[model samples]
Target: MLLPGSGSDDRFVRSAFAGPLSAFGITAVTPVPRPGAAVVDGYRAALDAAAAEPGPLVVGGVSLGAHVATAWAVRHCAALGSRLRGVFVALPAWTGPAGAAPAAQAARATAQLVREAGVAGALAQAAAGSPPWLADELGRAWPRYGPGLAPALDAAAVEPAPTADELAGLDVPVGIVALADDPVHPLAVARRWCAALPRAELVISSLAAFGADPELAGRASLLAWLKAGGR
Candidate 1:
């Protein structure tokens, strides 16, 4: 199973993978947090639930969720043994220094703004220069997206982001995919990921390759890699 980025309901990532994953007979479950709850807690609970059922569970996630999944794999590698396959990391936002990710900061700032002005008011400002599709999607999913997110984003921003030096030492294979035009998930980070790991692929996507691309097949490159890698 793969997880969504911080602030994104699991449905977003799950829907993106459901059709493609079915061809390979992979079943996915995206957990949604109860209102006003923390995403991490819900995620941990989800992971625990997943672990309760199977031996060979493959986990992957985007953004903060990606880090969580990766960390889980690393920590449990000895226990999961060969059952734990590889990881698929898509659009990893900055989890490092102050400037690592502006979107995280923007998200936090926007959250505070929303508390004051509400979703509509916040949507107007968030839509200013960002891609229309991204902004609109965020606005549409606002109700389901924001509650568990504020704390997640805050906690994620301080992650000592995986430096090339750090990633080079990871135990399992990792797949990195990025969007060139997207500021949240930077291409440079993906490049560094591919360069650092023993086995890693950096799939660079374009502006058109994301957003309006209906089939979402291009973005599915990560999913294809996941299935191929035995996920």
Candidate 2:
């Protein structure tokens, strides 16, 4: 199962992961986000539902989605045993508490902007300095959140990702993808996660490359997982 980042929907997840997963004959299950503060719980519920299915499961996503997947994997690894295949984490934003993290601060600021200026206004402000591809992505996604956008962004901003300790407890192989040039999702955070995980590999790509082809991150992540003995 794959989930989207803060303010993003399953459409972006599908665009990022579907083609790459399909190349390996793996189906990507992208779930729609539940509105408001329930967003994280909703994603966990989706992971729970997917875990009930028969086949080996690989759960992952980008940014906030990556945090949720890692937390779920840590929480359920022993219960699920080998049925839990591995994790593919792309652009992990922070470790442990969300306190003062750049991504968290950005999300909070965005949420405030959304509340004060509305989605269209917030989007315009965000797009002014964003890369063209990122602006396009925000243009497509931010509006989809509608009235729930601010609350969801706030919830994600404050939500805690798996800590270094939590990550260390996960025995399954992990594939991590990071963009060296992306400041919001720092490469240092990704490196910390890779170091903490018992079995893991890291792949570095440029945000420009990812902007040109969404699947680049996914492909790199899967390759990292393979290198870490995921299959």
Candidate 3:
């Protein structure tokens, strides 16, 4: 199962992963969080839903979803046992605690802006400052989320990544994809994760590549998994 980033839903997740996973003959399942659900809570619920399905599961996500997936793996690995196949983490937004990451800080700022200006107004402000492609992407996504987007961002902004201890304890094969040119999803964060996790591999790509083709997110993660000797 794959999870979407903050403010994104099942549609975006499917768009990002279905093509690449299909190449491997794997079906992708994405869960959409209810509006107004807190980030950690919503994602945990999604994880639970995925875990309930029969067979071993490869869990993956982008940005906030990636962070949450790692945390869930740490918490549930014992109970899940071999049913947890692997984890594919794309664009890990932060290491350590939540407030330290620039992406979290930016999300907080964006949430505040959304609270004051509303989603449309905030999107306009963001579009003015963002590259055309990012602007277009957000323009398409944010409205669909409506008032829920800001709160979700705020929730993610405060949510923490898996601790170093958690990373060390993880036994599953792990794949990470980092966008080299994206400040919010720093390469250093990705490297830190690779260094900390026992069975992890990292791959670097550009944000533009991700923007142009979301399926590359899946491809990068899959490549990292193959590098780690996962079947």
Candidate 4:
């Protein structure tokens, strides 16, 4: 199963992961996001439901979605055992507390803008400061949340990702993809995660490459996972 990032929906997730995973005969399932603070809970519930199925499953996502999936894996790895195959993490924003992280701060700032100016105004403000591709993505995805956008952004800003200790305890293979030039999702953070996880590999790419190919991160992550010994 794959999940979307903060303020993103299933459509972006499908575009990012479905095609790459399909090559391995893996069917990617992306659940619609719940609004506001319910976002994390909703994602966890979806994972629980997917776990009920009888096959090995790989869970992953981007940014906030990556954090949630990793936390879920940490919480359930013991019970699930080998039923949980591995994880595909793309652009992990932070580890441990969200405090002062660029991505967290950005999310908080966006939330405030959404509240003060509304989605359209917030999108315009965000687009003005972002690269063309990122701006276009925000334009397409932000309005989908409607009035719940601010609360959802706030939730993601404050929600803590798994700590280094938590990651160390997770023995499952992990494939991580990091954009070397992405300040919002720092390469240092991805390195931290790769170092902490017992079974993990990191693939470094550039924003230019990712912009040219949306599937670049997904394919790199899955290949990294395989390199880390994930079947």
User: What would you estimate as the lDDT of candidate 4?
Assistant: 0.92
What's the ranking of the predictions by lDDT, best on top? 2, 4, 3, 1
**Model 4 TM-score (2 dp):** 0.97
lDDT of 1 by residue, 51-98 (tens): 767666767777766766665665566777776666667777664353
Give the backbone clash total of model 2: 0
Q: Which has the greatest lDDT? A: 2
Could you give the candidate ranking by TM-score, starting with the highest? Answer: 2, 4, 3, 1
Distance (Å) between predicted and true CA of 198, model 2?
0.4
- The 10 consecutive residues of candidate 3 with the worst lDDT sum are 31-40
> All candidates' lDDT scores?
0.63, 0.93, 0.84, 0.92
Candidate 2 per-residue lDDT over residues 1-231, each given as its tens digit: 998999988988888889988999889899998878889999999999999989799999999999999999999999999999999999999999999999999999999999999999999999998889889989998887899899999999998999999999999989999999999999999999999999999999998899999788789989999999988
- Per-residue lDDT, model 3, residue 128, is 96
Q: TM-score each candidate.
A: 0.82, 0.98, 0.95, 0.97
Give me the displacement of residue 39 in model 2, in angstroms: 0.7
| Segments of candidate 3 deviating more than 4 angstroms | none
Write the number of the candidate with greater lDDT, choosing between 1 and 2: 2
Worst 10 residues of 1 by lDDT: 214-223
Q: In model 2, which range of ten residues has the least summed lDDT? A: 140-149
